[model samples]
Target: MRRDRIAAIVGIAESDIGVTPDKTVLQLQAQAAVRALTDAGLHTRDVQALFCAGAWTTWTNLMLAEYLGIQPIYTDSTNIGGSSFEAHVGHAVAGIQAGLFEVALIVYGSTQRSQRLRGKVPGEVSLTEQYEAPFGLPVPVGAYAMAAMRHMYEYGTRPEQLAEVAVAARQWAMQNPRAFARDPLSVEDVLASRMICEPLHLYDCCLVTDGGGAIVVTSERVARQCRHKPIWVLGHAETHTHHTLLSMPDVTSTGAAVTGPRAMAMAGIRHDDVDVAEIYDSFTITVIVTLEALGFCQQGEGGAFVSGGRIAPGGSFPMNTNGGGLSYCHPGMYGIFLLIEAALQLRGDAGMRQVPNAQIALVHGTGVQLSSSATVVLGRD
Candidate 1:
């Protein structure tokens, strides 16, 4: 396969980003799809492929394509939780490379927080749930909390170090109008926030909002005529270590360790070559472990890598510049938001959260219990 045919992202947008109760799931997806099409100055007829991770409905890819009145030549519905969108990007690139599709639309939407907002978990019938749910694994928060505890125990990481991540996210959120939690935060403030689970404060967790996002991908031949400057899909990879927390190889490590190197190698770049990063932050622990797993630092050094505001604004490297799922909107699966933020940075349209002259971006997504992972390297060069 030729690498030069990797798809380019020409259009991206998030519709009804926060607290959208009145909108239906399809409405949210359609609004975002239309906006992204408008952003690229293209029409639905131009979309040769469609992909979606619709958590709310079945046949989501077909449904969205029908709603948009687009008869796609190809489609994908690879539901790998939050990393689905990143995986869709990888599939679209491959499809484009193989001449299977000329243009593709990847979209996501969720009403998990608005209409059905309650203590609803992933139900009691998944393959992994069969094994873990019997023991009441607390689904997600408790699982992540355990990871935090282990990380702290193994690396001597302090709660203050984790607090810094929330504090820095807020600092970035203050500049993003679409962020769900923009109030200024401090390490002490995070420390003082009500504890959701041991070692993981409420501030350390992501927001529960109703929102949706969409991205339009196209081949190099077609992207040249698009409206925005093309953001190249340089390289990408995805993997998952386990289906349940108990099955996870190690709480301190994730699939990013493998996918990161694979992606960078395909992109022909090193860690230092990345100008910005948009990593999943379902919880502060996710960021810490993922950073270490992705080779940003040695294992267990993630606590110190983010210490003293290295990931905050005006720091050596800006992370989750969209306020992340921590301060920004986390409407169930948050992988799509990571891609949108990276595209914004590469396009020099990030406004106050922009990293100056950001040429390359590393976007990584993690799913439930860190069971699913995906990494993508995007560049303007």
Candidate 2:
């Protein structure tokens, strides 16, 4: 049955990837949507399903449909923070399998940087704020700071190990013409940078930029007519361990532990089959924790696993080939870009940063302050 069912990515693109104050979020979303549809050799009228997420607009799904003049029979606007788009991929595949929709469009856009809109801070809605916010718990970076400290205390995960993740991302960024941060970086350089929160230097954080990206998913029947090679959705799974940092069962571990193995199993492959990985890197600690959970290494061995140029540009395991959120554009939710890059790698279209004959790619997205996670495995036909 798994072999009989198939959903493939037929098109993908990005719009206004860097700072663009002139473009509103909806404009960015529309731009990416039209471009992605064009990439798939499709028009707005061909889209039967739509999915979008962001605080850029209320009812983001409806706004995108209206802007594109599309009337979709199915729509999804689920907002799970950074992992929303990866979850969208899983949903779109299920939609195609169930005959709910033939062609689905997933779009995302955010002006968090050029427009200086960080959206609502996480508080007052969860137990974290009820008990943790009173103590002035700075969201995201601050929460990640706590995780970094804990990882160090538990796994002997040094600040230097954290720096390797950032350094590797920048190395890949230098090869990306669209990357936001392409400057040379090293562990020593990262260590020398100013510290925002304890143990997390400036380089340990992800970039802030304005960007919009989109991907078109369709059943194999429609994919056969697309302009580009179809990147099949081999398997995928989504999971969330907690809504807030305080509620997290373990800072050193994440939902990737559950989603990764489940997705890999569904894909019928081992970790070694993946030619590249596109794990979310909102923070350096995110990459380390996620890699460990995904079975890349033992629980506390992420430090050693990512070290010694293992995940670097020319390393054995290519990761974040589009520079990831660390050096690439991070317009609020970054999961969309992860999917875009994975599809590109599998299609053998990733210029400069392309992994040689990359056949299988793994994409993982971390949501909120490392509370939610989603893993999707993609392959070329």
Candidate 3:
């Protein structure tokens, strides 16, 4: 049986993404949800489903539904690291198609920057943590650093090549008034920045910020009456490569190797047909690996592919138009923000950072050192 062709994104909203110290995670989630509902010209009463995900926050779907004065028929609190938000879109689409519910609200919020604490271990420790954390592989930077070093050794990748990603993201951030990393950086700047890990410098990492983002999905019939033009979900696919760094087959690739072709085939589009892309950038290496996995370049050519101003603002493929997690705000898991930015660009709502005549967009999300991957193809309808 063919899956139901249901669910179109009708509205998207995000709070001021940088250093929002005053708001709690719940408040940020509520504000973003209300804004999205308002943008869709719908009342709180119209919402019938809610999906939320994050770490270090409340699992308050019912509480939020009560706060918004709506009674949701269905609720989800799935947490799959950063890719949770994007995964929710796929789940919501399936739910709607299965006649479980309609008008689902997927939201994410975090206050990582304002909260300070002594270096403490995360609440839940996986088996991988039991094995690796004992050996000083505690944080994400360290895990990705090993991957970067391997790529450099095998592919002759240069530090300058990784710096190019950060530089291009900052250039786009300069154009985005709401972007967090407004200050631009050069290759020299990146190389000179303080080292967090041996291969990954301070500039090569994503920022910690306080922010929230939300998206409203509804059946196509309802989207026709919403405030903004609907950005149809042409196709979407997801894959889990591994749960831990040690279990991965190769550090230099991602589950995108599987997800990219599956999603493109579902959308009936090719790489050349994609007009814009918003690949998640939790680390510079994430982008490089994804670029190669998604057919932007050959397996070991990501470094050369990103060189010479290819991903800059006015280049052939303008990536991370809202500055990405690199130059934009990476409030913990930043995959949701990617979907928000991509939807806005497809709707033609991005003022200055908008890509001209953009009709097709490819948005990708990565979680936990390439553990989980999701790709969505969006089209203007």
lDDT (C-alpha, whole model) for all candidates: 0.89, 0.90, 0.85
Poorly placed runs, candidate 1 (over 4 Å): 1-5, 121-127
Where does candidate 3 clash, by residue pair? none
Task: Record all residue pairs in model 2 with backbone atoms less than 3 Å apart, i.e. clashing.
Answer: none
Residue-wise C-alpha lDDT for candidate 1, range 1-381, written one tens digit per residue: 214646799999998978877898999999999999889989888888999996677788778888989898998999988888988898999898888988899899887787875356554566646876766656588899999999999999999989888888888899899899988898988899898889999888988888899999998988899999999999999998887787888998999998899888888888899999999999999999999999999999999999898999988979999999999999989999999999999999999888999998999999988888999999995
Which pairs clash in the backbone of model 1?
none
TM-score of the candidate numbered 2?
0.97
Q: How far is candidate 1 from the true structure (C-alpha RMSD, Å)?
A: 1.7
* Better structure of 1 and 2 per lDDT: 2
Maximum-lDDT candidate: 2
* TM-score-superior candidate, 1 or 3: 1
Query: Compared to the true structure, candidate 1 yields what TM-score?
Result: 0.97
Query: Candidate 2 on 1-381: residue-level lDDT in tens?
Result: 133348999999998888999998889989999999999999999999999888876877777788889999999998888999999999999999998899999999988887776534653556345766667766788889999999999978899999999999999999999899988998999999998999999999998899999999999999999999889998899988787576888888999999999889888879889899999999999999999999988999998888888999899989999999999989988999999999999988889999999988999999998888889999886
Candidate 3, 1-381: lDDT as tens digits: 112357789989997678888988878888999899899888678888888887654646766677667788888887767878778888888788888887989888888888752135765667556766666664788878888999999999999999999999999899899999898689999999999887999999998888999999988878889988888887788889887789989999998988888888888888988888999998888899999999989998999988899999999988999999999899988988989999999988888999998988999999987788899888886
**TM-score per candidate:** 0.97, 0.97, 0.95
Error (Å) of candidate 1 at residue 207 is: 0.4
Clashes of each: 0, 0, 0
Q: How do the candidates rank by lDDT, highest first?
A: 2, 1, 3
> Per-residue lDDT for 354 in model 2?
93
